[model samples]
Target: MQLVVGRIGRPHGLRGDVSVEVRTDEPEKRFVAGAAVATDPASAGPLLIESLRWHSGTLLVRFEGVNDRNRAEELRGTMLVIDSADIPPSEDPDEFHDHQLIGLAVLTPDGERVGEVSDVLHQGQDLLVVRRGKTDVYVPFVKALVPIVDLDKGILVVDGPAGLLDPDAIV
Candidate 1:
């Protein structure tokens, strides 16, 4: 399985160093030097971690053969992937991997199908982007709002506030 671990940000300096928006919790294990990570577009590369270090709270990485800022800039916005048979389990029972939620059905408390989980947006809190007909709804993934996330059933039970799904008006 290819799991998304991080995204390459803009070049940090002139030495081909780039900042990473670490998506996985296990950065220490995933971002180790010499590790190979697949890129998003398929053509970019399996970006090898030639060097890895942390500055304050953020992680900085420099890939092998990418020796200048221009080379690093080319990789900006590219998602880093790691292929593993074992995706690390979430320590918190309530937490879930983005992939687990991505294609699940979204239903209201009354069991009406609202949409499908199209994407998982990670701001301060993760938001479930559901595609409902012609529109997209952003539902905050909180216990109060999304009470149930049943991976087996492939459904997310939401108790969204009025206008949460329909911004212009209540559904």
Candidate 2:
């Protein structure tokens, strides 16, 4: 299993530094200097991380053999990935990998089946994409909304507000 850790954004400066949109929670562990991460396009890398720094809260990365802005720009939109086997299991019970959450049954507080977790989106806010028949409900993955995650039972309970899970409900 390959897990995406980040995406290469536009070139940061004249050097080979490129802005990275981090996808993983542990950026320091995954985006270390001298680490080699595989790329989605396959041709772009195995990119060796020469160095990394935080610039105004954005993660900036420089790859080995990439010495100029033009070279860095070439890596734009490239998905940085690593083998899932490299990731250790989290000690926190509340923490979950996207793979673990996906395919789990989604239910309401009263035990009504809502859907199945099709995907986990990690934008500004984490969202679980629950597939309910023809509709895909975007449930905010918060303690208030998703209070239960019974991995042993392969089910998660969503305590969303009335219209939050109902796609057909008129706003």
Best candidate (score: TM-score): 2
Estimate, for each residue in 1-171, the C-alpha lDDT of model 1 and write its tens digit.
Answer: 577888999898899999999987568878889888888877999878899889988899999999999999999999988765567667988989888888999998999998999988877878889898878888888999999999999998999778787746756
Specify the poorest-scoring 10-residue window by lDDT in model 2.
162-171
Q: How close is candidate 2 to the true structure, as a TM-score?
A: 0.85
The 10-residue segment of model 1 with minimum total lDDT is 162-171
Where does candidate 1 stray beyond 4 Å? 1-3, 24-29, 55-58
Candidates in order, TM-scores: namely 0.80, 0.85
Per residue, candidate 2 scores C-alpha lDDT tens digits across 1-171 of: 788889999998898899999988779899999889999988999999999999999999999999999999999999999888877888999999887898999998999988999989988899999999998989889999999999999999999778888878764
Per-candidate local distance difference test: 0.87, 0.91
Total clashing residue pairs per candidate? 0, 0
lDDT of 2 at 10: 96
